[model samples]
Target chain A: MKNIVIGQYIPGKGLFYRMDPRTKIISVITLMIAIFLLGSIPQLLVAFSVCAVMMWVGNIPVKRVIRGMKPLIILLLFTFFFQIFFNKEGKLLLDEVMHVTVVSVLGIVLWTIIWRLLARIGKFKTVLLLAYIMGIFVLFRFLPFGYSFTTFRFAIYEKGIEMSIFVIIRLVIIISLSTVLTLTTKPTDLTQGLESLMRPLKIIGIRSEDFALIISISLRYIPTILDEAFKIMAAQASRGADFAEGKLKDKVKQVISLLVPMFIIAFKRSEDLADAMESRNFVPGKPRTRIHELRFGWTDIGVGVFTLAALALTIVLKVIG
Target chain B: MSYIEVKDLSFSYTGKRMILKDISLSIEKGEWVAILGHNGSGKSTLAKAMVGLLEPNQGTIAYDGVVLTNDTAYDIRKKVGIVFQNPDNQFVGVTVRDDIAFGMENLMVPQKQMLEMIDFYSEKVGMKDFLDKEPSTLSGGQKQRVAIAGILAMQTQVIIFDEATSMLDPYARRDLIEYIQKLNQEGITVIMITHDINEAMYANRLVILKDGTIFSDGDKWSLFKQPEIFENSHLELPFSLKLAAALDDSLPEEKAVKDFLWQSISNT
Candidate 1:
């Protein structure tokens, strides 16, 4: 009945939940911004290390955190493919197809190393999780690790330094921090924070209350929708519906059978909500009472000031560079 | 004055097939009423119409001498909050606390008072620990408890449970019924629509609707004098009541069929 698992939360008295939802939101955005603004190797090194430490503090499971990157697998390949021939230093994996720019032996080595480092520690940090996915990789068969592009194109040895372990440690930080914010704070508080953050947009007649309603409703119902889908899949599976062995066209028809029950449940839920709301005399108005109070305190200010100082120092370092 | 006066009410889903056909029911204030019939028997439609969620095609519904319409329905609604059949459908907030807070937020209660009320009602329904948890993760009974907490926090004068305990297991259902009984004792008017005849046994008034019309309406004790009522109305006697008939040969018991059955069965 009510016991439905959507995105399961790990109950913990960790620092993540102890922090206010608004504070968590602000810190997440700030850290993400810092990760993007960083350019130099030392800055990336520092930023990535900080993320690593935060991940360790949050106590999130490392593999589960890494597995979150399953969707971004294609993006990594695109990064590799785009930079490969253009590096113009590594051994040519293949001759330029239809006059595509050719890679020298040195190009591939530098591209691999730089891509591995940046994509793992960079804004979209999924490479740390996917380091071991062995598809048909375009390896530089002629470049050496210590040698630069200038030296590698003319060389013949296939020696290379393995991708670093620090990258996974780096990713564990980003995903763990994400879990810190989302898994600990309830969705209502998350929207309350967003509503407060977007208060300036109210001048344009975009009411945060209405926006919060949309968010809370979706947050509340999407899991139910997914659960409904799962239930239908199980029900049909029990009924000997041939979802598993069917051809593509037959499978599509089988999946469509699920749409009927899902929509019925959805409409029924909506109707019930409307009835409950009407009975409660629910009216749209100002001065709404929230169960959880979103507070800003000394700790929030301290966290904010610390992050602000980091931002300022990052700017200064960038200027010096 | 009739607490709820429905006069010549008629309705259809798409203007073709009428769900309620010129039905009229007068439920006096402080009355605990059970609207009962098989599925698609217009019992739920009447409940919806009573709360102003559904517009009857004809006639009028008035509460405490005030007509129920969109213009005045808002005020009437404050006096009535419904607990739906499926515990899942009525819950609307992200967390148990937030879900209960939805109606309060809509009602626009002050923040401090809202927090107090949330704590009070959550504890009232024994969901004090689940305030921070999502509704999806709670058991069906707990979800219904949260749903009850939400309506209870609203403090409406009339509460309708539309098969609200169907999803709950037996033990939780008993507890929920006891909760409702306590609310009714506190002078809150409760209306329940149920197919479960046992649930109806607990109601003060049972209004049997057969094919969009009231087949029988009266106190629960007196209604069972005619055993044939259930035969024609698509209802069966509660298991307790049926068991009471089986024990008629052995010992003296209350004339109330359900009580007799339960007593005789338990005495054994």
Candidate 2:
């Protein structure tokens, strides 16, 4: 659970860290829009280079950034497969029909047994697994046995691969840019930036300050709530709840028990928090000053202008192309 | 007028079950008062009422002559602060420095003054080194100390500890009690609500509550003299107090009780 690092701010001293949060946030949005606007591979390479530079200049650890993308691996894979299977443009890479029969079924089963044994034989299991999947695809394309009427055709188009790479790169760039912003900016500054950026919404009757306050408070409590939930889980486990080792029905009952206690604790906590807040003289809707004021210096201006220029250049090039 | 005055205070959560009943208490400026009670004995409820967190169903609570009503609750709160049990729950900020600044921000203290107060009070509570650390990362004792620092930054005349150290270990509890004692000695009124009679011994005055009412309110020495009151209130006598009572001989004092115990153990 501690590995879940969404919205976490890592302290650092770098260009992105020193820049005002509003600048970082606006720049990230602009960069993301620019990435989406890129039409050709060259433009994407440029965008990727810009993100790489930002990551480097921010002193963000490359390994940690990749770890941040761990949760998106499944989504990236899904998009990759969806684009590859459904897309039907550009030159064809493979087109073949293969038949399946009792002999082929038995052969495939035997092959799978061998593949499983091979998978366990070495440290390169991932490589072996990929090779096995490719082998199965190859067998489906070329292997011939059984009735022709039941034959299956498998094809791969060049455009499918290009499209998949494009989409995946776009997603990676967007996610990494946002991660950079969160990594560089503290949660309080982020909230303050959002509040100030959305201050104009006050004319439309939206309380952005209050909204920012709620978001900041919820972000602060996420880890604390998770810690409490784990404690409750442990306590229930000590009482023989058997959350880990149980039938589906019993596991669900155990989960419900945990949730009930969590909800009760949360409600009680919110009540206590209300009392604490009130005792400290916190009045909702009243203007409160902060100790650290957000100031937009020359660096913020430079970064803001640079991002806007990049966004405009992308839009113009995309239009011309 | 006393520093804090609560007269004929009564509170009922559902208008059916009374949590506090006809409670009247007053504390002088710079006095340290400890409220001791068993579980569900309404001591916490009383603390809340004193801090303007809960509205009493009847009676009035005044701080520095300002009545704690709906209209004046905010003003009254500015003069009073509370450190509740469950250190994690009361934390309103993401970091220790932010939590300490929370009250100052609410009071609209200027940025310069807020920073100075945060530095002074955090150092006073011995949490200057932990200003950047998250509240979750701090120990229970450290969190309570941060809470105290936050209250101290508010510069309130009276600070109430609503069993704040109950969740801490013995060492942390003693460390917190020492901080609270230091704060009291600095002319801040301290109201400590706890179930630990040993902890209550640190206070100059002790108030014992039983079943939603004040059972006894007097000096600590007078309260320790009556072991039956301790039993009736479901509060344990400290080791020295219990030994003194069992032996049917008055002990010299709390400090002497330990020396006497050591001598007796050696003699035996």
Candidate 3:
């Protein structure tokens, strides 16, 4: 199955579903900048509220959004504890005798920050668009980057750690944006947008139709593969195959057995695809009419403007704060 | 030139088993030839070899006097296409539209032509509503319909049905046979591999195989006249033909004997 569902996109006339993928993508970039640039409490709160409103407008169930947080619960808790106990720079919300022991404080802060940030990165990719953005704010307190001990510990202060942190944060924002785009737009519609967006690249001798066909096929292949995987699993179960009951070696062997059948099916499909393609007389450099043409209505213009505004605000906040 | 000519063709599979030994056959333009044999009799192997899917160990295969080579095999494929037995294995596209478009793509058909051809062939197969439907959503018969449409859309003069209708239920099989007969009437050379003697009866020509050898090659009447041929090839005669033979003891010179037996059975 594909990393994303293809034509399996939900069909509806909902407002969020009709927006351009490009605009949605740009909006994601705007959110990323805003997340990174916000260093103060007011800015972070504003970012959090914006994500929350978007989630409501998109009609996604809030419970499902929060359910995605299950994978990062530990990281979230760590970050919150780190921020409370170690980040002495922040205001003290609690106090106790011997509570602020230097070793414990440092370890807790380091571990908490690392886990919190890791949670955001993981949730951004795992959660849907609005859910991912909400996750960024909700998971902010669980940074796992800090230490979690009450005693002496070894630590490294290097550029590698710094880069890794930034990389994870960037991945979250990018994933969140793509999540929104995929959830709201149909794959076919997205392909058209991709084609149009790449139209300018024709001057450099790139044909967009070929690219569009590849994308559309890939998207279509995803759901089919997933369905095939489930079928294979069921077939294996019926034959007394077990995935969870095996030891490490047995699991590896079991997975290998599964791959054999899957590979056979995939190769057979590729051959058929080649034959089908040959028979259909599909040639490069041929013009074809799209039955479903994407048009920019006034709503698109409004969305574009809103996206640009969001982007401008994000940049200004980053520079100012 | 004949539609397709294979002179003294011979092939062998693994273990030095001779399959299609010295198999010389020529199919004229617009002639429907039915090849009949039991399983492992090399009938399907011969059919595949003729379509350029399998290479001949000895002997040349030609279409319209053009030799079959790597570069020229494609041209032969354009003039001829094979529909395999399994419908699921025959399809490449997830959707009917894509599958039909697939054939046209290989021939380098322009996008506009591909669309028109896809519509034309899908309609030909009577799958208008299923154009956008996924291949899995179709029934076995419907998938065959799509497969046939894929070949026909390619406009191949010679189409080989390699047990194409074997997987379908009786009703669907009957309909598919009728559809194929219609294509034969419309001047498309059809070659079908089947053990069904009744289905092969519709062909103007028949070749019966036994143990990788042609046991009987002639008109349907001649082939049926030799009961030994059916015994050796593991085939059963159609009921009417068998009844006609049984009545030959009383009416030795009866004309239209099959018709007489049919009338008797229906009246009974």
Interface RMSD of each: 2.6, 1.5, 5.5
Q: Is candidate 2 or candidate 3 better by lDDT?
A: 2
* DockQ for candidate 2: 0.63
Worst 10 residues of 1 chain A by lDDT: A154-163
Q: What C-alpha lDDT does candidate 2 achieve relative to the native structure?
A: 0.84
- Ranking 1 against 3 by DockQ, winner: 1
Looking at candidate 3, what is the lDDT of residue B181?
79
The TM-score-based order of candidates, best leading, equals: 2, 1, 3
DockQ scores for all predicted structures: 0.55, 0.63, 0.23
Q: Which stretches of model 2 miss by more than 4 angstroms?
A: A1-9, A90-94, A98-133, A156-158, A203-205, B223-234, B245-268
Error of 3 at B210 (Å): 3.5
lDDT for A312 (candidate 3): 78
Summarize candidate 1's per-residue lDDT along A1-321 as a digit string, tens digits.
Answer: 356544535556765666677788888877766655655445667776676676677665556555655454465454444444244543444442111123434454556576677776666555443442321133433323453344233222111101122333334445555755666666567788888788788888778877987787877888778888888899888988866797999988887798888888888888777767657776664556666667777767877787788778777776786
Residue range B97-201, candidate 2, lDDT tens digits: 989999889889999899899889989999999998877678989988888888888878888999998899989988998888888888989889999887787
Counted clashes in each candidate structure? 15, 0, 45
Candidate 3 per-residue lDDT, tens place, B1-268, comes to 5768877778887738788777777789998889998888898888777766668888878888988866677777888878777676666665788777667666667777778888887887789789987765677788888888888877889888888888889998888888787888888889999878877887878988777777778887677677777876788887775777667555545756666775664342
TM-score of each: 0.76, 0.88, 0.68
| Ordering by DockQ | 2, 1, 3
The residue-by-residue lDDT of candidate 2 on A1-321, one tens digit each, is: 544454657877878877988888888888888888999777787888888987887698777677778777768877988998889999999787766765566667877998889977766665666666677776666666664436676778999999999998888888888888877887789888988899999999998879987887787788889988899888877887777787888888878888898899889999988888888889998988897788888889888988989999999998899
